[model samples]
Target: MIGRPLILTTLVVAVLAVAALFVVPRLGGATAEASDLNLEAQPRLGASDAPVQIVVFEDYLCPACGQFAETVFPRLEREFVETGDAALYHKNFVVIGPESERVAHVGECVFREDEAAFWEFKRVAYRSQEGLNERRALDLVSEYLPGVDAEAVRTCAAEDLALEAVRSDVGTAQALGLRGTPSVLVDGSEVTATYAAVRTAVEAALAAR
Candidate 1:
């Protein structure tokens, strides 16, 4: 009787260990492939050689993403990005609609024109997200992003000049198995989409390095 109970206990432990092997990887333990990330040509903040790499997948029309941009992103920018502890890269998921894609194209155009102005355009785009359309998006870009060549951006979006770039970002997001906007990844591991979570992840990544 004693031997049988001990055997059952060992089996249970073995099963749980195997379960954790599968569960942990699903819960941010597995790192994504760097090549699939397509970090090249993406807009980024912080030093190029930062120890921690933070990737943010966002859709222009996602309200949660806007909230993150307005609140969480600023904290990350200050605490990690500005300090050169981590580099933040932006990628478009474009889950909303055609308008979202158009806005993304315009954003890419702004980035091409002036990388600095692209951040400003992002702020204005999120702030003016209500009832946003192609025309309104272009108008807001023109009105707010003074440094950007508004006419050039307008032409780029109208002619879909930046479509391939936007689509590439979308593909990258999908390849990483991101299911929603405002997904945050630190050192190629997905984390909860919040400032606290992201800060912790960044700190952990920094420590690991």
Candidate 2:
């Protein structure tokens, strides 16, 4: 008993609403909740079956991310990730520029080569980010990942696979409504990307479990 005209009007309104939703958030430098966030293949540390999942969306060149890595990550690794209470994941949200994106791409390659090396790569990247050059990053990566092939990494990082890895990560970040680097999401809920917030959330999640 639905009239054609009524059906058409409803569809139009629905389309407009969806369009508006996408437009509104971008105007404020914020984003709508991301669609289809898959953390399965992302670089992770700690046990896979950990009760709490702490995901960080960050850029290599972001100073805040560096601060989080330096000030908070060690304690996090010790208190949660190392203890097997929680797993930490890094999702590349490359927004800084070419150098940042390049490093992100390299990070993907590093993670693929050795999951254990990814953590150190992040640590070294954050520690000596004053240069932020792609060549410098590659060199640092080699230094941290000694067995890794710098020339091979240079080739792989420039390949489509590496580009897509970082691109996909950035897409996931956007879908999660991340506004800036060092965004930590616990159980799909965005939390402050800080040691205190992450620890509290992890403890709470563990307690609840």
Best by lDDT: 1
Report, for every candidate in turn, its global Cα lDDT versus the true structure: 0.85, 0.79
lDDT (tens digit, per residue) of candidate 1 on 1-209: 57988999999999999999988767753257666777768888888788888999898899999999999999999998888898888889888898898888888888888878888888889988888777888898889987778999988888888889999988877777787898888888889899989989888878876
Write out the backbone clash pairs for model 2: 34-175, 34-176
Residue 209 accuracy (lDDT) in model 2: 79
TM-score of each: 0.85, 0.80
Error of 2 at 95 (Å): 2.4
Q: Cα lDDT of model 2 overall?
A: 0.79
TM-score of 1: 0.85
Candidate of highest TM-score: 1
lDDT of 2 at 62: 91
